[model samples]
Target: MAGNSDPLTPRAKIAVTAGKAVAAASRAAGRGSGSVIGGRVALKLDPDLLARLAQNLDVVLVSATNGKTTTTRLIAEALRAAGPVVSNALGANMPAGITSALAGGSEARYGVIEVDEKYLAGVARDTDPKCIALLNLSRDQLDRAAETRMLAENWREGLAGSKAVIVANADDPLVVWAASSSANVIWVAAGQMWKDDAWSCPSCGGVMQRPGDDWFCGECGFRRPTPSWALSGDHVLDPHGSAWPIHLQLPGRANKANAASSAAVAAVFGVPPQVALERMYQVQAVAGRYDVVQFQGRDLRLLLAKNPAGWLETFSLIDPPPTPVILSVNARGADGTDTSWLWDVDYTRLTGHPICVIGDRKLDLAVRLEVANQQFQVCENLDQAVQLCPPGRIEVIANYTAFQDLRRRVGN
Candidate 1:
C-alpha cells in the first residue's frame, strides 16, 4: 500500500516507475497534465483556479518597478503582527508562480505576494486582496516595458476596480494620482526628492512646475499631491544630512525613497509610526544591493543597478572604501532588458581609478566606461574578473539581473 506517507522502497519504485513513464509519455505526446499539484493531473485547469484557492485566504498583492520585494517582505512582517501569514518569499511573481505558491497554503489565514506589473490585473481579479500596496514607478526596461507611459497605463488599468484599501506612495505623482481614485486610499510620502515636483507632464502633454513638493501642470492643471502616511524628515538618519534620518545599510537617495515608501505603507497597515521608524532603521542591505561583504580579505560594497534610477542611486551611496571597484555588467537577461539606461548613469565617479568591468557584455560596458576615459580592467567572464581584483576588499556595482548572480559567484 504505497502512498505519499510511505518511504519509496525498491519494489515501490519499480511499481511507480511504470505510472511515471506513462505520464511522461503522455506529456511527451502532448496529452498529459503540464504540472502536478495535490497529486492531480493539472494541465488545463480553469482560469478560476486562483479564485478557488483565494476563497480560503486574505490576499495582499504588492506591485511596483522598485522596492516591491523589500516592501512586501516588511509589510508581510507587519501584517503578521495582525495574524497568521503565507507568501511567495522567493519571488516567483507571475500568475502561474503565484498559483504555485498559493497552492501550498490552503490552511493559512493570509497571503501576500509581490506581483509583476504585467500580471497585476490578472492576479488581482483572481486573488481579490483586501489590501494592496502600490509602490512608485520609474523608467526600467523600456524594451520590455515598451515605455514608461505604457507601464503606467497598465498599472492604472490593473488597479481600476480593486476594492482593497490602497497603500500608495504620495511623492510619485504617477502612483499617488492613479490610486487616489480609490475610495479609501492610505497615502504614503517620503521626504521630497525633487526640491520641486516640477517636470514635463506625461499627461495632457504639458509642462509641470513644483508648487512646494507637489507637482502642478502649467497648462492642463493635472496635479499630484502628497500621501496621508509620511515620515517627518527628522525621524530619518543619514550622515549626508538631507533632513531625513533614513538609514540604508546601502547608502543612496533612491534607497532613502525605497525605505520611505516601505515605512509609509507599514504605517497604514497599522504599524505605529514610531515602530515603523524603528523597523526601517533595522533594515539590512540584501546581498548585492549595496551589500558590503569581505572578498579576498578586502571590504567590498556591492551595488546592483538595473535601471537609470538604480544607477543614480548607487552613485549616491558610494562612500568608497580603500579597495577600488569591480563594476560588472552582462548580456544576461538579468543585466537589463536593454543597456541604453547605462547612458543615463553618471559613471564619471569612477574616473581615474583602476576599475574592472566584467560580464559577457564587457566590451559594451567598456565602451561606456571609456567615454569617461577611466582606466579599467575588463574581463568578459566572472572567473577572470575575480582573478584580476586584488586580494583586498573592494566595492562592486552590478546592473540588473547580473547583480545577484554575479555576487553569488564572486563573493565566495
Candidate 2:
C-alpha cells in the first residue's frame, strides 16, 4: 500500500505547489472554491499527481446516482474516529476535484473520496482504495452520463479483479450485478426507492422478478445475494443480526440507508458500528443539501433533487402540507441540458402544498406541475416566491445549479 513517506517526484512537487497558488487566486477572486481549476492545472503539469498524493492513505471511494456526497461526508466523519481523514466534502466528485482535495490534505491518514458515477473506475485505479462503496445506480444526466445498464457494465468490468473490499447495495439489482464479480464484497440491503431503472436483469437482459425485496432473473436465475447488513425500519442490522437505531440529524429514510453503507465501509477501517454511527450522527447536512436559512423573514430550507430518483427522495424530506414548497430547476452544464426527466417525477405529491416554481427552467417545471394537476405560481426569482409565502418555515427543492444559486442567494 502507498504510504505518506513515499516522496512525490520533483515535477509532481512543483505541480502541487502551483496548484495551491492557482486555488488561492481563485478563492481570492470569488470565482468559487479553486479545487476543480487548481486540480486541472496540477494534472496538466503532472499527470500522476493524484496517484502520488493518494500514497500513504487508506482511501474509501463512494459513488452512486444519489446520496454519494452525503454518504461520503458520513463515511469521512466515521473514519475520523480512527485518525485524521481527508475528503472532497464540497461535492467535488470529478478527478480534478478529487485531486485538489487529496493534494490539500497530503498528511491526512485516510482519503474518503466522493466519486462521480462515471469516473469511479479511473479514480479507483489511481487511489487503490481499501474500500469501495457502491450505492444504487439510476438514470441521471441523461444527456451526458451513460445509460444506467452500460454504466453498470463499466463498473463490473472495471472492478473485475483486485483486492479492495467492495461494500455494495444488495437491494439495487444494478449495484448487485456490478459488484457480484468482485471477490471480497460486503452486501448491504440498502433500500432502493426508485426502481424504474432496474426492471431488467443486467446479467442476462431478462425480466427481473422482484418478489418483495428478493430479486432474481426469470431467465438466467441471477438472484439478489443475502445481505450481510440490512436496514430494519429505523435500525440497521449488522451481519451478526444486531440492530442499531439510526438517529441522525439528516432527515428522511434515504439518509438512514446512507448511514448503513457508511457504517459498513467504516468497519473495514476498524471503526466498529457503535463508534461509526455515533460519529456519523454529527453530519447535519452535506454541501448545503438540507440547510435551512432565514430568508426574507422566513426560514427557507434548501433541498437538492437533480434526477427523477433524487426528486422522489427529496419529496419525502419536505415539510408537510400548508408549508409552501418552492420547486426550482436549471438546465445548465452542471444540471444536464435535458429537462425530460422532470416528467418522470410524480409531482402530484406536492398538490396539497402551496407550490411555487422558480429557476432558469421554471417554465419547464410549471408545465410538468400543470400536467400533474398541481396548481403553482411561476416566480421570476426566489425573493418573489418567498414574498408570496406565509411567514415561518418554507421548503425549497432545487436541482444541481438551481440549488447552488439558491444557496448563494440565501448566503448559506
Candidate 3:
C-alpha cells in the first residue's frame, strides 16, 4: 500500500481478459447461457463446445450490397427446417466478431453470418466457410468502403483457396467476376429485369442483351457461365402485409431476392428446392424491412434505411411517398460513423412535408431535406416527434440502429 502501482498493465489486462473470456465461453457452451432482451431470451448460445456437438458442419456465408441481414436470417430459418445451425443473428461477421459468435453457439451443425463488405477478407480467413452466398453490389459508403467493385475484388481474393461451395447472382457484373475463378461457384439468376442487375457490358457500358435468360456482353466476349439456381419473377410480395396465405416474415421485391438467395444456399446443402421455397413463403416480415406499427392513433410505416441500396429497396416497395412522414437519422456516429450517406439517398422521391426529424443529428436530416427541396419539420427529440405525429396516419423512416430505438419508443 506504500506505493500505488498500476495493478494490471494494458497488455496484461488483455491477456487476462482473453483467458477469462475463453474460460467463461468454455463453461457457457455446455449449458444454455443467455441474457434477457425485450423480455425474452431472444437468442441462444453455447460457444465452441456446442459447435463441437454439431454433425457434418457445412457452414454457409452470405455477403451482399443489400439483403445480407434478411437473407442470412432467412437462410438460418430455412436451415432450421433441415438441421441445427450456428449463426450471429445480428450480422456480426468480422474476425473477432465471428469468433465470438461461433464460440458462443456450441450446438450447431452449420455456421452463417451476414458479413460486412470491408471485413470479408478477415472473416473468410478465420472461418474458411464451405458454402458462400454473394448478392449484388452498388455504390455505398464511399468514405468507408472505397467502392463496391473494390470490395468485390477483395472478396475474390479471400475466397480463392476456400474449399466452400459458392452461390452467386449471375446478373451482377461484379459477381460474375468474383465467381470466375472459383471452381465450386454455383451461379443463380433472379429474373428481375429492373435496374438491380448489370444488363450492360462492363467495357463499353452499352446494353448487353440477355439471350434466353443467359447474359453476354455485346461489346466484349466478357461473359459468365449460367447460374446453377435461378428465379423468374416481377413485383414479389411486399413485407408490409400483416400475414399472407403463404407467410414470409420478410417480404418485398428485395426480400424476394433475399428468399431466392437463401433458397440457393439451402439447395447447396442438399435441401430440396420445394422445401426451401415453402420455407420462404411461410416466413413473416421481421422488425426492420417495412415493418408497419400500429400506435394508439397513428399507423406508422417503419422503413429501415442504412445504405443507398437498402434505401433504394425501401423506395421500390413504397408506391409513392407516404404523406406527413417522419425521418430519423441516428447521426450520433453511433450506428454508422458517417452521416453523409444522406447525400446518396434520393430524398426527392418523398412528396410531402416531414412531420418530425428525430435523433441526435435531427438537424442534419432537416437541413438535408431542405437542400433536397423537400418540406419538413424538426421535432428534434424522438418523443416530440412521436407526440407530433399525425394522429391518424404517418410514415416513419429510420436507419439501422435507429429503427430499433424508435420501435422501443413507440412500443412496437
Candidate 4:
C-alpha cells in the first residue's frame, strides 16, 4: 500500500509533529494508548495521512476475528528478511493504530498491518495493500461489532474493489464468501475449529452442511472452495503438494494454522515457504499471548481468550487432566461489558481438571462452571490463584484487560 509518490503537504508535516508530541506525553504519563491517540490527532488534522503515507510502499494487510496479531507478526518477520518492514507492534488494529505505526516508521519501505475486521474495508481503501490475508471470522464483541454475517458482507464489499491479491481461509465459509469475488485469490485450508458462527451460510442464509472438514450450502450450492494450500497433519501443504513442517515456539494447533496462513501470504511476496517457516520459529510470543512468567515461586503461562471462540482454542492448548488452570474474566471496556459469551463456550471440556476462577467477573465464570458440572474455586487475586495451582508451572487463561493485568502484575 503506497500513496501517490508525492511529498507530504506542509499542513500534514505539522500534524505529524504535534501528534508525536502528544504521544510522547501520553507514554511518559503511563497511558497505554499513546499511539492510538497520537494517530487519531494526526488523522483529525490531516484527514488524508493514511493515503499519503501509503503511497509508493508495498503493504500487506492481515485481518480476522482471531489470530490476526500473531499472523501479522509472522508475516512481518518473514518480510524483515528482505528489507525494512513497519508494522503495528501493539494489538491496536484500527485505522489510528495503523496510522501511528506507519508514522513512526517513515523510513521503512514495506508495511505489514493487522487491520480490524470491522475496519478492513476502509483501511484497505486507504492503504491499497499489495496483499490482503483474510483469516477466519467468528462472533466477537457483539456489543461492539454488531453481527458476524454483516461484518462478512462489509469485508466482501470492501475487498471486491481493491487491486490487491487476496489470501483467504477456504475452510471458513464466511471468508470464502467475502473473498470469492476478488480479482486475485489464493485459498488456504488452515483448519477452522470454531464453527459456531458459520452454521448459516453467508451466501444463501441456508443451514450449511459440514459432514466433515468441508462445508457447503445446500440451498445456494455454495461449497468450500478447493484450497491451494492445506495442512496435512502437522505439515503445511503447498499448491504443488510439497509439505513443510511448521515448527512454531508457540504451542497450539491454532498457531500452526496461523503459520500456514502466513506462509501462503509470504509466498505472494516472493518469500519461499522454507524461508517463511524458518523465520516464524523465531517468534516466541505475540504481545502477551503465549508468554510464561514467574510469579511468587510459580511459573504462569499466560493465554488470552476474549470471546467464546478464543476460549475454545485456548482450552485445547493447555495440558489435559492433571494440569491445573486459572480462568480470569473481566467485563471491562477493553473486554466487552457483556460476560454472556461465557455460557456459549463448552466449559464442560474441563471435566475433571482442577480450575481456579479469578478476575472482576470471576463469579460469573464460577456460575457458568457450576452449570457445566465442572468444579472450580474462586480467587480474585492473581497471587492467590497462582498459589492454588500445583508447584512448577500453571496456566493462566484470561480475557483482554484481565490478561493485561496479569502480565503487568507478574512483570512479564
Best by TM-score: 2
lDDT values for all models:
0.62, 0.91, 0.63, 0.88
Per-residue alpha-carbon lDDT of candidate 3 for residues 1-412, written as tens digits (9 for 90 to 100):
0112333344433433453355456457742222111101111232232222212355777887677777888888788777777776655554434544554444566777777777766655655577788887776544566565566678777778777788888777777777666778877764433344365555456677676666677776777566555554632221221111224655466776677667778877777555666776655555445667776656777887777667766766653444567777774443565777777777787756445777767877778888888877788566567677655556677776688778777776
Cα error of candidate 2 at position 23, Å: 0.8
Query: Predictions ranked by lDDT, top down?
Result: 2, 4, 3, 1
TM-score of each: 0.78, 0.98, 0.75, 0.97
Model 4 gets an lDDT of 0.88
lDDT of 2 by residue, 215-297 (tens): 89989999999999988888889989999888899999999999999999998998999999998889887889888898888
The residue-by-residue lDDT of candidate 1 on 1-412, one tens digit each, is 1012323344433423443444466558765232232112221234455565566677778887766766666656655655666776656577655665555554566787888877777788877787778876677765666455566666677778678878777667667656755787766665434221225665665776776666777897777654455555444322232334555453555555556565555545555544554555555654335566765555667777666665665665665543567777765654445777677667887664458887656787889888977778877665566667766656677765567666666553
> Distance (Å) between predicted and true CA of 192, model 3?
7.1
Q: Distance from true position, residue 170, model 1, in Å?
A: 1.9
Off by over 4 Å in 3: 1-56, 191-220, 234-247, 285-290, 294-297, 319-323, 332-336, 352-355, 391-393
Model 1: ten consecutive residues of lowest lDDT: 34-43
Worst 10 residues of 2 by lDDT: 1-10
Taking all chains together, the TM-score of candidate 2 against the true structure is: 0.98
Model 4, runs deviating above 4 Å = 1-6
Q: What is the lDDT of residue 168 in candidate 3?
A: 83
Which should have the higher lDDT, number 1 or number 3? 3
Judge candidate 3 against the unseen true structure and give its global Cα lDDT, from 0 to 1: 0.63
For residues 226-311, write the lDDT of model 4, one tens digit per residue. 99998777899999999998989999989989999889999988888999999999999999889988779777789998888888
